[model samples]
Target: MSNNNLIKGSLQTIILKLLEEKDRMYGYEITQKVKELTAGEIKITEGALYPALHKMEAEGLLTTEIQQVDNRVRKYYSLTKSGKAEMSSKMNELHAFIDNLHRILNPAIDPKLNL
Candidate 1:
Protein backbone atom coordinates (compact mmCIF):
# COMPACT_ATOMS: atom_id res chain seq x y z
CA MET A 1 0.00 0.00 0.00
CA SER A 2 1.17 3.49 -0.78
CA ASN A 3 2.17 5.46 2.32
CA ASN A 4 0.73 8.35 0.34
CA ASN A 5 -2.48 7.18 1.89
CA LEU A 6 -2.74 9.15 5.11
CA ILE A 7 -4.21 7.40 8.07
CA LYS A 8 -7.32 9.38 9.02
CA GLY A 9 -6.33 9.85 12.65
CA SER A 10 -3.14 11.78 11.89
CA LEU A 11 -4.46 13.86 9.01
CA GLN A 12 -5.80 16.61 11.24
CA THR A 13 -2.43 17.16 12.91
CA ILE A 14 -0.60 17.42 9.61
CA ILE A 15 -3.15 19.89 8.30
CA LEU A 16 -2.98 21.99 11.45
CA LYS A 17 0.81 22.12 11.38
CA LEU A 18 0.84 23.29 7.78
CA LEU A 19 -1.71 25.97 8.46
CA GLU A 20 0.12 27.02 11.58
CA GLU A 21 3.39 27.57 9.75
CA LYS A 22 1.74 29.45 6.92
CA ASP A 23 -0.77 32.21 7.65
CA ARG A 24 -3.35 30.43 5.53
CA MET A 25 -3.56 27.97 2.65
CA TYR A 26 -6.14 26.81 0.14
CA GLY A 27 -7.18 23.21 -0.35
CA TYR A 28 -5.19 22.43 -3.45
CA GLU A 29 -2.16 24.13 -2.01
CA ILE A 30 -2.47 22.04 1.10
CA THR A 31 -2.70 18.89 -0.99
CA GLN A 32 0.30 19.84 -3.07
CA LYS A 33 2.38 20.79 -0.07
CA VAL A 34 1.82 17.44 1.59
CA LYS A 35 2.55 15.65 -1.65
CA GLU A 36 5.78 17.54 -2.15
CA LEU A 37 6.95 17.19 1.43
CA THR A 38 6.36 13.47 1.36
CA ALA A 39 8.26 13.18 -1.92
CA GLY A 40 5.01 11.96 -3.46
CA GLU A 41 4.75 9.21 -0.90
CA ILE A 42 1.57 10.62 0.56
CA LYS A 43 -0.96 11.98 -1.86
CA ILE A 44 -3.89 13.71 -0.24
CA THR A 45 -6.99 13.22 -2.35
CA GLU A 46 -9.76 15.79 -2.86
CA GLY A 47 -12.35 13.27 -1.75
CA ALA A 48 -10.56 12.97 1.60
CA LEU A 49 -8.99 16.39 2.09
CA TYR A 50 -12.07 18.51 1.38
CA PRO A 51 -14.38 16.80 3.80
CA ALA A 52 -11.69 16.88 6.47
CA LEU A 53 -11.22 20.59 5.96
CA HIS A 54 -14.93 21.19 6.20
CA LYS A 55 -15.20 19.13 9.33
CA MET A 56 -12.27 20.93 10.94
CA GLU A 57 -13.88 24.28 10.10
CA ALA A 58 -17.18 23.16 11.52
CA GLU A 59 -15.44 22.05 14.68
CA GLY A 60 -13.94 25.53 15.11
CA LEU A 61 -10.42 24.19 14.78
CA LEU A 62 -10.07 26.09 11.53
CA THR A 63 -11.52 29.18 9.90
CA THR A 64 -11.73 30.12 6.25
CA GLU A 65 -11.25 33.29 4.26
CA ILE A 66 -12.20 33.71 0.64
CA GLN A 67 -10.76 35.83 -2.12
CA GLN A 68 -11.27 35.98 -5.86
CA VAL A 69 -8.56 34.21 -7.76
CA ASP A 70 -8.68 33.79 -11.51
CA ASN A 71 -12.40 34.61 -11.35
CA ARG A 72 -13.00 31.89 -8.82
CA VAL A 73 -13.56 32.39 -5.14
CA ARG A 74 -10.93 30.33 -3.37
CA LYS A 75 -11.25 29.48 0.28
CA TYR A 76 -8.18 29.51 2.47
CA TYR A 77 -8.02 27.87 5.87
CA SER A 78 -6.05 28.93 8.89
CA LEU A 79 -5.68 27.42 12.29
CA THR A 80 -7.61 28.81 15.19
CA LYS A 81 -5.91 29.28 18.60
CA SER A 82 -7.23 25.92 19.70
CA GLY A 83 -5.75 24.39 16.61
CA LYS A 84 -2.36 25.86 17.40
CA ALA A 85 -2.41 24.28 20.83
CA GLU A 86 -3.69 21.02 19.44
CA MET A 87 -0.80 20.68 17.04
CA SER A 88 1.73 20.18 19.78
CA SER A 89 -0.24 17.43 21.41
CA LYS A 90 -1.01 15.77 18.11
CA MET A 91 2.59 15.80 17.01
CA ASN A 92 3.66 14.13 20.24
CA GLU A 93 1.01 11.49 19.77
CA LEU A 94 2.08 10.83 16.22
CA HIS A 95 5.71 10.41 17.17
CA ALA A 96 4.80 8.02 19.92
CA PHE A 97 2.72 6.01 17.50
CA ILE A 98 5.49 5.80 14.96
CA ASP A 99 8.07 4.83 17.56
CA ASN A 100 5.87 2.12 18.96
CA LEU A 101 5.16 0.82 15.50
CA HIS A 102 8.85 0.72 14.67
CA ARG A 103 9.71 -1.33 17.70
CA ILE A 104 6.89 -3.75 17.06
CA LEU A 105 7.60 -4.19 13.38
CA ASN A 106 11.35 -4.57 13.66
CA PRO A 107 11.76 -6.54 16.87
CA ALA A 108 14.34 -8.90 15.44
CA ILE A 109 16.68 -6.87 13.28
CA ASP A 110 19.95 -8.75 12.70
CA PRO A 111 22.56 -7.22 15.03
CA LYS A 112 25.55 -7.58 12.70
CA LEU A 113 23.90 -6.43 9.48
CA ASN A 114 24.21 -2.60 9.78
CA LEU A 115 20.67 -2.21 8.65
Candidate 2:
Protein backbone atom coordinates (compact mmCIF):
# COMPACT_ATOMS: atom_id res chain seq x y z
CA MET A 1 0.00 0.00 0.00
CA SER A 2 1.13 3.54 -0.68
CA ASN A 3 1.83 5.98 2.12
CA ASN A 4 -1.11 8.13 3.17
CA ASN A 5 1.06 11.21 3.07
CA LEU A 6 1.84 10.65 -0.60
CA ILE A 7 -1.75 9.78 -1.45
CA LYS A 8 -3.28 12.63 0.52
CA GLY A 9 -2.82 15.51 -1.86
CA SER A 10 -3.94 13.59 -4.92
CA LEU A 11 -7.14 12.13 -3.49
CA GLN A 12 -9.33 14.83 -4.91
CA THR A 13 -7.82 14.46 -8.35
CA ILE A 14 -8.17 10.72 -8.18
CA ILE A 15 -11.81 10.91 -7.14
CA LEU A 16 -12.67 13.50 -9.73
CA LYS A 17 -10.97 11.54 -12.51
CA LEU A 18 -12.75 8.37 -11.50
CA LEU A 19 -16.14 10.10 -11.43
CA GLU A 20 -15.37 11.66 -14.78
CA GLU A 21 -15.11 8.19 -16.26
CA LYS A 22 -17.57 6.15 -14.19
CA ASP A 23 -20.54 8.61 -14.38
CA ARG A 24 -21.72 7.85 -10.81
CA MET A 25 -20.57 5.91 -7.77
CA TYR A 26 -21.33 5.34 -4.11
CA GLY A 27 -18.79 5.73 -1.30
CA TYR A 28 -17.86 2.11 -0.85
CA GLU A 29 -18.00 1.61 -4.58
CA ILE A 30 -15.52 4.43 -5.05
CA THR A 31 -13.15 2.86 -2.52
CA GLN A 32 -13.42 -0.54 -4.18
CA LYS A 33 -12.96 0.88 -7.65
CA VAL A 34 -9.83 2.72 -6.59
CA LYS A 35 -8.42 -0.40 -5.02
CA GLU A 36 -9.18 -2.37 -8.16
CA LEU A 37 -7.58 0.24 -10.34
CA THR A 38 -4.39 0.43 -8.34
CA ALA A 39 -4.21 -3.30 -7.63
CA GLY A 40 -4.35 -2.69 -3.87
CA GLU A 41 -1.51 -0.23 -3.91
CA ILE A 42 -3.82 2.49 -2.61
CA LYS A 43 -6.59 2.22 -0.09
CA ILE A 44 -8.89 5.09 0.78
CA THR A 45 -10.22 5.19 4.32
CA GLU A 46 -13.74 6.35 5.12
CA GLY A 47 -12.33 9.09 7.31
CA ALA A 48 -10.53 10.62 4.36
CA LEU A 49 -13.05 9.78 1.67
CA TYR A 50 -16.24 11.24 3.13
CA PRO A 51 -14.72 14.58 4.04
CA ALA A 52 -13.33 14.98 0.56
CA LEU A 53 -16.62 14.00 -0.99
CA HIS A 54 -18.55 16.41 1.20
CA LYS A 55 -16.07 19.19 0.51
CA MET A 56 -16.35 18.67 -3.21
CA GLU A 57 -20.12 18.64 -2.98
CA ALA A 58 -19.97 21.91 -1.08
CA GLU A 59 -17.65 23.34 -3.73
CA GLY A 60 -20.16 22.44 -6.48
CA LEU A 61 -17.78 19.94 -8.01
CA LEU A 62 -20.05 17.03 -7.20
CA THR A 63 -23.72 16.29 -6.68
CA THR A 64 -25.27 13.44 -4.72
CA GLU A 65 -28.41 11.33 -4.78
CA ILE A 66 -29.63 9.12 -1.97
CA GLN A 67 -31.13 5.80 -2.96
CA GLN A 68 -32.78 2.99 -1.03
CA VAL A 69 -30.79 -0.15 -1.54
CA ASP A 70 -31.78 -3.31 0.34
CA ASN A 71 -32.90 -1.61 3.54
CA ARG A 72 -30.05 0.84 3.36
CA VAL A 73 -29.48 4.32 1.98
CA ARG A 74 -26.63 4.75 -0.46
CA LYS A 75 -25.37 8.16 -1.42
CA TYR A 76 -24.21 8.25 -5.02
CA TYR A 77 -21.92 10.93 -6.32
CA SER A 78 -21.38 12.31 -9.80
CA LEU A 79 -19.52 15.23 -11.29
CA THR A 80 -21.53 18.34 -11.90
CA LYS A 81 -21.52 20.28 -15.20
CA SER A 82 -18.85 22.59 -13.86
CA GLY A 83 -16.84 19.61 -12.66
CA LYS A 84 -16.97 18.04 -16.11
CA ALA A 85 -15.68 21.24 -17.68
CA GLU A 86 -12.86 21.38 -15.14
CA MET A 87 -11.74 17.79 -15.60
CA SER A 88 -9.39 18.31 -18.52
CA SER A 89 -7.69 21.30 -16.97
CA LYS A 90 -7.33 19.57 -13.61
CA MET A 91 -5.87 16.46 -15.24
CA ASN A 92 -3.45 18.54 -17.27
CA GLU A 93 -2.36 20.38 -14.17
CA LEU A 94 -1.79 17.12 -12.33
CA HIS A 95 0.23 15.68 -15.21
CA ALA A 96 2.35 18.79 -15.40
CA PHE A 97 3.01 18.68 -11.67
CA ILE A 98 4.06 15.06 -11.88
CA ASP A 99 6.32 15.78 -14.82
CA ASN A 100 7.99 18.59 -12.93
CA LEU A 101 8.51 16.35 -9.95
CA HIS A 102 9.95 13.69 -12.24
CA ARG A 103 12.49 16.15 -13.63
CA ILE A 104 13.45 17.34 -10.18
CA LEU A 105 14.03 13.81 -8.95
CA ASN A 106 15.81 12.64 -12.09
CA PRO A 107 18.44 15.15 -13.04
CA ALA A 108 19.36 13.36 -16.26
CA ILE A 109 15.98 14.07 -17.85
CA ASP A 110 15.04 17.46 -19.21
CA PRO A 111 11.41 18.35 -18.53
CA LYS A 112 11.30 20.70 -21.52
CA LEU A 113 12.11 17.86 -23.91
CA ASN A 114 8.78 16.44 -25.13
CA LEU A 115 8.83 12.70 -25.04
Candidate 3:
Protein backbone atom coordinates (compact mmCIF):
# COMPACT_ATOMS: atom_id res chain seq x y z
CA MET A 1 0.00 0.00 0.00
CA SER A 2 1.16 3.51 -0.62
CA ASN A 3 2.26 5.44 2.43
CA ASN A 4 -0.70 7.72 1.97
CA ASN A 5 -3.03 4.84 2.67
CA LEU A 6 -1.57 4.27 6.15
CA ILE A 7 -4.25 4.68 8.80
CA LYS A 8 -3.76 8.25 9.98
CA GLY A 9 -4.61 7.69 13.62
CA SER A 10 -1.72 5.27 13.91
CA LEU A 11 0.73 8.10 13.50
CA GLN A 12 -0.02 9.58 16.91
CA THR A 13 0.39 6.22 18.56
CA ILE A 14 3.70 5.78 16.77
CA ILE A 15 4.94 9.15 17.90
CA LEU A 16 3.91 8.63 21.48
CA LYS A 17 5.39 5.15 21.66
CA LEU A 18 8.65 6.24 20.12
CA LEU A 19 8.90 9.05 22.63
CA GLU A 20 8.15 6.65 25.46
CA GLU A 21 11.20 4.64 24.39
CA LYS A 22 13.60 7.28 23.13
CA ASP A 23 12.59 9.95 25.68
CA ARG A 24 13.15 12.58 23.05
CA MET A 25 13.43 12.55 19.27
CA TYR A 26 13.85 14.89 16.38
CA GLY A 27 11.48 14.85 13.41
CA TYR A 28 13.69 13.04 10.93
CA GLU A 29 14.62 10.42 13.50
CA ILE A 30 10.98 9.74 14.28
CA THR A 31 10.17 9.30 10.59
CA GLN A 32 13.17 7.04 10.11
CA LYS A 33 12.30 4.94 13.14
CA VAL A 34 8.73 4.49 11.93
CA LYS A 35 9.99 3.37 8.52
CA GLU A 36 12.49 0.95 10.03
CA LEU A 37 10.19 -0.43 12.70
CA THR A 38 7.38 -1.03 10.25
CA ALA A 39 9.79 -2.52 7.69
CA GLY A 40 8.96 0.35 5.35
CA GLU A 41 5.28 -0.49 5.41
CA ILE A 42 5.03 2.97 6.97
CA LYS A 43 6.78 5.84 5.38
CA ILE A 44 6.35 9.11 7.33
CA THR A 45 6.94 12.18 5.31
CA GLU A 46 7.79 15.65 6.64
CA GLY A 47 4.43 16.80 5.38
CA ALA A 48 2.68 14.30 7.62
CA LEU A 49 5.01 14.50 10.60
CA TYR A 50 5.54 18.21 11.02
CA PRO A 51 1.88 19.13 11.20
CA ALA A 52 1.05 16.39 13.68
CA LEU A 53 3.98 17.35 15.83
CA HIS A 54 2.99 20.97 15.78
CA LYS A 55 -0.55 20.09 16.67
CA MET A 56 0.60 17.89 19.52
CA GLU A 57 2.81 20.65 20.76
CA ALA A 58 0.01 23.11 20.55
CA GLU A 59 -2.23 20.77 22.45
CA GLY A 60 0.33 20.61 25.29
CA LEU A 61 0.95 16.94 24.65
CA LEU A 62 4.52 17.58 23.57
CA THR A 63 7.28 20.03 24.19
CA THR A 64 10.05 20.98 21.81
CA GLU A 65 13.61 22.08 22.29
CA ILE A 66 15.62 23.52 19.48
CA GLN A 67 19.29 22.78 19.17
CA GLN A 68 22.13 23.30 16.78
CA VAL A 69 23.97 20.33 15.36
CA ASP A 70 26.68 20.70 12.72
CA ASN A 71 25.40 24.16 11.91
CA ARG A 72 21.89 22.86 11.41
CA VAL A 73 18.97 23.63 13.66
CA ARG A 74 16.79 20.79 14.83
CA LYS A 75 13.72 20.62 17.00
CA TYR A 76 13.39 17.69 19.35
CA TYR A 77 10.08 16.59 20.84
CA SER A 78 9.39 14.90 24.14
CA LEU A 79 6.25 13.91 25.95
CA THR A 80 4.84 16.29 28.46
CA LYS A 81 3.24 15.07 31.66
CA SER A 82 -0.10 14.76 29.94
CA GLY A 83 1.54 13.15 26.97
CA LYS A 84 3.02 10.48 29.21
CA ALA A 85 -0.35 9.76 30.74
CA GLU A 86 -1.93 9.65 27.33
CA MET A 87 0.68 7.24 26.04
CA SER A 88 -0.53 4.34 28.13
CA SER A 89 -4.10 4.71 26.96
CA LYS A 90 -2.93 5.24 23.41
CA MET A 91 -0.87 2.05 23.57
CA ASN A 92 -3.81 0.03 24.77
CA GLU A 93 -5.97 1.47 22.04
CA LEU A 94 -3.37 0.61 19.44
CA HIS A 95 -3.17 -2.96 20.66
CA ALA A 96 -6.93 -3.26 20.49
CA PHE A 97 -6.94 -1.81 17.00
CA ILE A 98 -4.38 -4.26 15.75
CA ASP A 99 -6.29 -7.11 17.36
CA ASN A 100 -9.43 -6.05 15.59
CA LEU A 101 -7.65 -5.70 12.27
CA HIS A 102 -6.12 -9.14 12.65
CA ARG A 103 -9.52 -10.60 13.41
CA ILE A 104 -11.00 -8.99 10.34
CA LEU A 105 -8.15 -10.10 8.12
CA ASN A 106 -7.81 -13.67 9.45
CA PRO A 107 -10.90 -14.43 11.40
CA ALA A 108 -10.79 -18.18 10.96
CA ILE A 109 -7.23 -18.32 12.17
CA ASP A 110 -8.09 -16.58 15.43
CA PRO A 111 -9.40 -19.20 17.80
CA LYS A 112 -11.24 -16.65 19.94
CA LEU A 113 -12.81 -14.94 16.98
CA ASN A 114 -16.35 -15.95 16.09
CA LEU A 115 -16.34 -14.21 12.73
Better of 1 and 2 by lDDT: 2
- Model 3 misplaced regions, further than 4 Å: 1-3, 109-115
Q: Which parts of model 1 have CA positions greater than 4 angstroms off?
A: 1-6, 108-115
For residue 4, model 3's alpha carbon misses the true position, in angstroms, by 2.6
Q: RMSD in Å for candidate 1, one decimal?
A: 4.1
Task: For residues 57-86, write the lDDT of model 1, one tens digit per residue.
Answer: 998999999999999999989988888878
Write down the lDDT that model 1 would get: 0.84
Pairs in steric clash, model 3: none
Q: Which of 2 and 3 is ahead in TM-score?
A: 2
TM-score of 3: 0.84
List of clashing residue pairs for candidate 2 = none
Instruction: For model 1, give the 10-residue run with minimal summed lDDT.
Output: 1-10
Best by TM-score: 2
